[model samples]
Target: MGVWGFLKTQFVVHLLIGFVFVISGLIINFLQLCTLPLWGANKQLYRRINCRLSYSLWSQLVMLLEWWSGTQCTLFTDQETVDHFGKEHVIIILNHNFEIDFLCGWTMCERFGVLGSSKVLAKKELLMVPLIGWTWYFLEIVFCKRKWEEDRDTVIQGLQNLRDYPEYMWFLLYCEGTRFTETKHKISMEVADKKGLARLKYHLLPRTRGFTTAVQCLRGTVSAVYDVTLNFRENKNPSLLGILYGKKYEADMCVRRFPLEEIPLDEKEAADWLHKLYQEKDALQERYFQEGTFPGPQILPPPPAMDSPKLPILGHPPPLTSNLVCNWYLRQRLPPLLILSFLGFMWTASFAVRRLIGVTEIERGSSYGNSEVKKRD
Candidate 1:
């Protein structure tokens, strides 16, 4: 293998990358915490600052997927569907079939200029994880315990908090609840049989509680539901570790937009609608397996130059100049420098701390020796 390829396989490289991510993430999390006082004074400005700070941390993982792993993600949907992607608030329902699915979602968020502000309905345990979890706490990401009774209020309140959010956001919901595996799929299908629901060959039955509550709470605030189904070509199961090891894969995401008004307002009806959506998503996956592509007309590729406008889509919104400037600075220039500075500062602080501790130990040892000498004399 080439030197670069050899380095990619080494554990040391992954450790260093992870270490940097954690330290830098914690730094950004601290900065986010510092914005708490500003919340009451200038809520919108506070949100904007947190969004930029979020981008600083999240862009590190995006860089790994886009630059280090060399993964190419393609969006397959009509231009009309995603034209207002970054400009509007939407709930993103995605299939949980891959470990790196969240990262894939983040990549799309980056494309749509909402990476920093993108939210998710994540598991409660994730709230305790360091760095990423701490950051999410500041981002107001909804966390659920997977128990309907326990999560109902928390989920609704979290969704309600976003009603007056300053920037556009894509709230992600993995209604499937857990990552897909054959064993879990089998058990889920059995439950579907017991419930007399349609059998889903490619996906587990979606938990509708979260979706229904989010829709009900965010009613006027969220415009549409983006039903996003993602799959990796050739790799039936893609893990985060594989991405870390520089595995290149092609990801296809098929997004279908549904107006929030069209989704039933009643809780029961909303739950049924989510089930039907999952059934359709299952059918799409079946088609993908057979055709090796999504069932849609391909949008023309954007120009090779980074500065060129992205591919045209239906109902595209005019670019926001402020957002564009923020995107450029955060995505392109800031993350790397911020991470490197954090690493340097951490290293220097650790060295200083160790030296200080050593000096104290040496002084104590000398004092003890002098005491012994005086006693002997």
Candidate 2:
């Protein structure tokens, strides 16, 4: 085979890359933990610095989905709505259909300069997913158990903690509470029918408790609720592994940001508001199916390379003027660098192992050949 063809089939090479990703992620999380001291000294600045620090590491993995994996993201949002998006804090409600929807959300966050600072109201089950989950802990990604009976109070407390997040953030909420499989969709429609709601063809029953709870808790602190619907072109089901392997696909994100005042402050009213919002979202999805896009003017963020920091650098280190700045800088750069360094080392070791050990190619014997002949060969 030619060199380019061989490169495409290099499974071990990809595994080596994944090792680098896992290692770098852990280092970022560790560095975030080390920022605890900075939090004590200057809470706001510490929170802000950590946001950037966490993004640098996480966005690398996100870039793997687009740059390395060749996935294309097409966001069709209103021009007026997106032009002022970076200036506000909003509750982002997304359709939980695709497995890599979170990654896609992260991609949007990366584009908007908020990937590291982005937050999610994720299920508790996700917190066990190794590097990604552990990193999310420091990012302050909220975890929900799905059982409102158990998660109500805990979810409220988690939202309350974000009242002081120092940077503009996009908090993602999957109102459906789970991915949409055909079986799950059927069950959700049944539930919706039981609740006296119309059946939705492309969705599962949304659990209103979590949405209401989040709205009620994050009311004053958040400015708006961004109702986001994500769908892939041609109904392609994309996975995280597929995205990492350079699989090309298109994703459409439709966003509608509404003022917080629209959501009711009362708990029951909040629940009703969520139901109504879902109904509207369902209608929007149907319209998208008919028209092939959301009803909005197109607005896209500038490419990532355009966002360069404006700070000047001196020839030598400054005399320790402020402990907070020192810690903030330390918290931002140290751990991710170390972890990424370590992962690179491990990946090199694994590549060496693959080279030195040498992979043995096995040839399949024909069914018509005699068993004894095959064994002799």
Candidate 3:
């Protein structure tokens, strides 16, 4: 292997790069937390400052992925719509199959100068995820429980909060509450069958409540819906580790902007709107399978600001099961396990406290009864 390629293959190098990015991100996020008190005194100024700080932190991670990992992200949006991407507020509806899709969306947001202020209706579980979730909280990312009964009001309020955000932002909604899996795909198809709509081979059934609430809340604030259809060229299971390990893959993202006027205003109509949107996206995917492309004018977004010239092109190495295991252990299990443990401890303590209080109350009652009997004697 060439010297450049040899260096890329070194596990320690990737580890150090990842560690540095994560640590720096934590520090930046901490600084952002320090600005919370300022919001009460000067909301807009605090928001503007927080925006730049957020971009700095997120851009570092994006650079690590895009520049260090040598992952190239190309945007195929039209110039007219692309130019206005960061200039105004818009609702972004993205497919939620790939883990890195959100990262890719963030990269696009940065290129368009809106990464700091971008928002999404993400799974409530993500709110418990470290760094990413903590940052999302400050960035005003709307979280949903995926249960309409619990999520309805809070989600609407979250969307309403975006009405006067200081900077331009792209509010993303997956519509499909979870990642696409075979089981989910089968169930979604069943739902589609029941609805009498053609089944989609590539996606899961989208929960429409969140999408409808988003449209209703963002009605006047958002100008258009950027229906993004993303497909990987090689149809392999894409993971963050795979992308980090110099896995060369191509992605075709088709962005179609539909005016707000085209979407219906009522809740049921809004739900129908998302169903139709997915149907069209499914058709787009079918075209991709048949003809290998989305039939629309392609606009390549400018190379990301952090793209470096001295990048090494390293082909896929033997699967680093060790690194993969470590990442899986840390990223997937550790955080939630820690949170669950904390909650468990809290619950136990709460129960114990209640028991103690009950005992104390019984003793106090016994003492009072004895004193009353002595007084009667």
Candidate 4:
């Protein structure tokens, strides 16, 4: 193996990278906490700030997939569809088959210039996770307990909060709710049998509550539903750890955009719509297994390049200064220097507080002792 390849396999190198990620992520989370008070003053500005903060953490993983691991993500859609990607709000219904499926979705988000502000319908437990989860809380990403009775209101309210959001966002919904495993898939198919639904070979039965709720809540705010199907070449299964190990993989994504207006307004009808969509997604996956490609013609050339220019939308905003500054700082400075500074500041401040408090308590205890002794005398 080459020197760089040998180095990539080193456990210490991966640990160092993860250490950097955690420290930098904590700093960004701290910065996000500072924005909480700003929400009442200027909600849009607060949202904008958070978008950039989220990018700082999320882009690290994206870089791991795109640059470090050299994963190729090809979008199989027409030119016309590509133009509208980053301009409007979208609800992305993606297949959750691989461990790194979310990363592939982020890859598309990065391409469309929405990586910073992308949201997901995630499990509630993730909200407690240190970096990524804490950041999602600020971004207003919806979380559910997988219970329709409780999650219905929480999901709707969360979606409603994004009505006046300033920047464009792609809200991802992994309707399958969990990563695919053969045992889980079999259990899901058994549930499908009970429901009299069609069996899906490549996917588990999608939970319609999340999908229908999102569509119902954000009917006017979101423009289209991007039915995204993802497949990895060579490696049928890809894990996040594998990406960290610099294992190269090719990801193929087929996106079909449907306008929100076309979807039925009634919740039950909408649920049925999602079921049909998943069926189509299953068919698409079957085709991939057979032909080694998706149904549509490829928009970009083979082995997609990371630097390709994104499709231009009709009313897309001109490049903003904030985005440029945020990208530059995150890419150039945040990892090493800022991590050390933040950690140093935190350690120093904590030590000083503890010492001051300890001294104060000791002094007070001494005074109490003296007073008791004098009274006894």
Question: TM-scores of all models?
Answer: 0.79, 0.78, 0.77, 0.80
Q: Give the total clashing residue pairs for model 2.
A: 1
The CA lDDT at 277 in model 4 is 90
Model 2 poorest 10 in a row by lDDT: 310-319
- Alpha carbon lDDT of each predicted model: 0.74, 0.67, 0.68, 0.75
lDDT of 4 by residue, 266-295 (tens): 989998898899899999989998889997
lDDT for position 9 in model 3: 64
lDDT preference between candidates 1 and 3, better one = 1
* Candidate ordering by TM-score (highest first): 4, 1, 2, 3
> Who wins the lDDT comparison?
4
Q: Which segments of candidate 3 are over 4 A away from where they belong?
A: 304-377
TM-score of 1: 0.79
Q: What C-alpha lDDT, on a 0 to 100 scale, does residue 236 get in candidate 1?
A: 59
Candidate 3 worst ten-residue window by lDDT: 308-317
Q: What is the C-alpha RMSD of each candidate to the true structure, in Å?
A: 14.5, 11.9, 15.5, 14.2
lDDT by residue (165-284, candidate 3, tens digit) is 878888888777766666567666766788887677777666777777777788888889899888777565455655556555566788988888898888787777787788888888
